[model samples]
Target: MNLTVARLTVRGLLGRRRGILLLVVPALLLVISVIGRSSGSDKHDLAVTILGELSLGTLVPILGLIVGTGVIATEIDDGSIVYLLAKPLPRWKIITTKLAIAVVTTWAFAAVPTLLAGLILYGTQDGLAVGFALGTVVAGAAYSAVFLLLGVVTRHAVVAGLGYALVWESLVGNYVQGAKTLSVQQWGLSVAKAVAADGAIPAHVSLAAAVPLLVVVTVAATAFASVKLAGLTLASDE
Candidate 1:
């Protein structure tokens, strides 16, 4: 992919109204962190739960959905993607470049805020800061790839992504023990388990299962997004 094209796309995706929308998630986390810290109600489990569940599980995925799909689907919808597609760049390169940008942006916005939120809430106890940071990074990257693929393969990417992140993973996993095995939020909690001091954070899934699933989901999503972009078609305005 052309670096110039990627740079331009990144700048545009982050500029204007989209940037405000992207900031909403991290901003919400930080705001809640400030409020929680000031109220003198800070507790270890509460910190762990908030950073673990809300930051990793909810905010990261939402930001990923907005950023990942915003990067390409908006272009596709407005027909500007034709300009990029008409060029001589390899399709895989284009997809890879966009995916990379999405992943990095998601991490910056989601993971960094999570780290700061952790520090604000818990100070330096039980490796909570480190564990939650790592968890956010992994979850953010996976969310980027998954949502990027959604952007390429479907027009209703935001809706579908929200449904999966909110309804399927959050709702179903909460109710069904079997569903926890298949949840990304749970996979991220496993990473938290590895980073946290012993008995500090808890995870339902084991490290053995979570690691492979994280790698596979991220790599597979990236590969599938590349393939989809290679064969991507823009619908006619007719």
Candidate 2:
């Protein structure tokens, strides 16, 4: 991986308005978790609703979109990517460096917040906090790679990522049992179920199925992005 590309990716990510927006979802997760904690409601119910639906279901996908696409989208949009591509660096290295930045930053923004949110809502009961944290981290990494591929392949990366996350995973995955098998959120949920105390979380996919799929998706997306970037052709805006 090219450190220069990685350094540039890091600067571009944190130096934009998107960086400010990145904090919003995690902050919202924490605030809602605090409210749930005080409700004196069923702890499991609160944990499921807060950490399961809101944190993993909502925040993780959104942050993934912003960070994943943000890494390359803005540069591609402004025609600045041509400069980077003009260099002799291997296209795969550039993709790998950017992918690393996206994954790590996404983990910090999504997974850590999910952990904190779980603690606020459930206080390590049933190993729920650690389980959900693991789920989000793994899911966040997958989202980063997939959405980074989207950024490289499509100008409408954010819209595409949102449709998959919200419409496909959140909406359709809920209604269709088979759709859950193909969902990163559900795959990660399986990991959470395995890690948490038995019966603490319900997962539609099995850990055996989820683990291999997660690895395959992440690897395939990164590979495809690298191949696509190697063939990228930047025409003049005018």
Candidate 3:
């Protein structure tokens, strides 16, 4: 990996407007946590519902979409990736660097907020903070890899990511049992189940299934993104 290239890419991906936008989701989580905390409805189950369902289920995926795609999509849009590709650096290194940025940004924007929100909402009961935090970390990394690959493979990354996260993961997974088994939401839920106290949380997929899927998605997406980046073509306006 070219440290100079990686540094430049990370800076461009994370600076200015993108940085502010990245903060919004977590700000919303904190606001919700504050309200929930003040309302004196800090039951462990309620905390689980809010953090597990609302934060992990919804917010994290969206943030991942924005950040992961932001890392590569903007370069693609502006045709700046050509400069990076023209260099002697291996395409895999570029993808890996971008994937690393995406994962770190996802963790910063999603997982950290989740930990703070868990602290505010439930005050560390049942390892809820640790469990949900761990789950968020894992899910964020997966989301970053998947969304980054989407950016490499298509111009429609945000739309495709939304469709997968909202339409397929939420809607279809809820209605179709088999789909639930394949869902990232469920996979993270499984991790959360393992981390939280026994019976504190429920996950449709078991740990056996979730761990492998997470690893597979992260690794496959990274590998595929590297391959795609190596041969990525830019259409000339001429």
Candidate 4:
């Protein structure tokens, strides 16, 4: 990771409106979790729904889309990426540095809040808090890599990412049994299921499948993004 590139990416990512979104989205999750805890609902069911559906399903992807795309997409869109690309740095280093920033930012916003939300809702009983927290961390990382690649490969990264998160992961992955196998949410949930007490969390994808897929997707996306970045030309002002 190039420190200079890392610094610029961090500033570009967190020093703008995207910063507000990162803060707000997680705060909303925590607020809802507190309300849900006090709602006199079944704690286990509430925890499951909030953490699984809201935190992992929604918050992680949203933050991922924002941070992942925000880190480099803005630079690319504005054609300022040419300045960085002209530097005597390997394209892969630049991509990796931006990706690292995205991953860590996503973790701070998504994973930490998820852990707090889990603790607020379910406490440490059945290891639910830790389990879901772990899930969020992994999922957040995977989402960062995937969406960062989208940013590199397409101008419409946010729209593409939203469709994947909302349509594919949230909608289809929920209703269609076969689709769960291809879902980042389900993969993360599998990790939670393994860590939480048996039957405490329900994950359609097995841990065995989830781990390999997560590794493959994250690595492949990062690698592909590097290749794409290496060949990237400045966007025309016309």
Candidate 5:
């Protein structure tokens, strides 16, 4: 990746109130986990609720949206991306650079806290903590790629990202069986369930299906975003 592009992406992602916003969700998760750990709540319930629903469902997607879009969408919207695109750099490198920053940021703010929350809630019993943590890592990376493509493809990147996460994944997926197959949350959940002692939690999609879907989605999104960015640069110059 380009160091210059990587530096600029990091600066943009962590600058202003954006960095603070990224911290809020993870901090909130850790706090809640600590409290839940002390309370009368059952460990299994706490782990599934906080790590599964809160971490995987809510925190991962939103962080992916903010970091992914914030990395490039803001620059694109402000027309500052022109200078970067005009540079004699490989388009894929630029995309990869920004993508690397987004993945790391999302992992730090989402996955790390998730692992902590899982451990606080359930320890290593039945592989609960590690399982969910692994799920978060993979899911966070996938979310970053998907949302990064949305950032390049839409002016309403955040709105679009939220709609897909909340409306499509959370809402529709719960009631619609077919929708769950296409959900990042469910895919992650499937991964988590696979790691934990048998039947520790529910998983809708099979491991075979979920793993491939997750890989395909991330790679496709990145490939498409790179192409779109190249096209945008060419169109702007015309």
Candidate 6:
């Protein structure tokens, strides 16, 4: 990964309005988690609902959309990407560098918070905290890569990403039994189920299926983004 490109991407990502969102969204999760901990509810069930539905199902995807698109989408939209593209930098290096930034940022905002939320709500019972934390790491990475590719390939990356996260993963993946096989959320949940005590967490997709799909989606998205970036041509100013 190119250090210069990584630095610029980081600056661009965190030095804007999107930075506030990254901070606020995770903070909201922590706040709700604190409240959930104090509520007189079934801790395990609360933990499952909060971490499984709110954290993995919701937070990871939203942060993924923000950071993933923020890293490069603005540059691409404003035509500043051509300046970077003109440099003698490999396209794959650019894509990977931005992707790395997105993954780490997503982890910082989503994974860490999810872990904290899990602990707050349920403690270490059944390994739920660590299990869901690991799940966030994988899911966040996949979401970053997928959404970054969306940023590269389309002007409406955020809208497209929201539709996928909201409509596909949140709605269809949750309700449609067969659709769970193709969901990032379910894939991450599978990891959590494997790590947590058996029956502690419910995941529709098996770990065997989830792991391979996670690897495939992340790798494919990064590769395709690189290819697309390599083909990008700056529009001429009249």
Question: 144-198 in candidate 5: lDDT tens per residue?
Answer: 9999999999999999999998998778876699899999998999898899889
Which ten-residue region of model 4 has the weakest summed lDDT? 229-238
lDDT values for all models: 0.84, 0.90, 0.86, 0.92, 0.90, 0.94
Query: TM-score for all predictions?
Result: 0.93, 0.96, 0.94, 0.97, 0.97, 0.97
Off by over 4 Å in 2: 233-238
Winner by lDDT: 6
Q: Candidate 2 residues 1-238, lDDT tens each?
A: 7889988989999985877899888998999988888887998888887888898888988999999999998898888999998888888889889999999999999999999988888887899999999999899999999999999999999889989988997998767998989998998899999999999999999999999999999999999998878767434322
Q: Give, for candidate 3, the lowest lDDT window spanning 10 residues.
A: 229-238
Q: Model 3 misses residue 180 by how many Å?
A: 0.9
Kindly provide the TM-score of model 2 when superposed on the true structure, using C-alpha atoms: 0.96
Task: Please write out the lDDT profile of model 1 over residues 19-97, one tens digit for every residue.
Answer: 9988887999999987888775647867977897889888888888888888788887787888888787877788778
Q: Candidate 3, residues 1-238: lDDT per residue as tens digits?
A: 5687778878997788988888888899999988888775647867888888888898889998998899898899788988877777878888888888888888988899999999998887888877888898999999999999999889988889989989987788767988988888888889988998998777889999999999999999999998788667333322
Overall local distance difference test of candidate 2? 0.90
lDDT of prediction 4: 0.92
- 47, model 3: CA deviation in Å? 0.7
Q: Give each model's clash number.
A: 0, 0, 0, 0, 0, 0
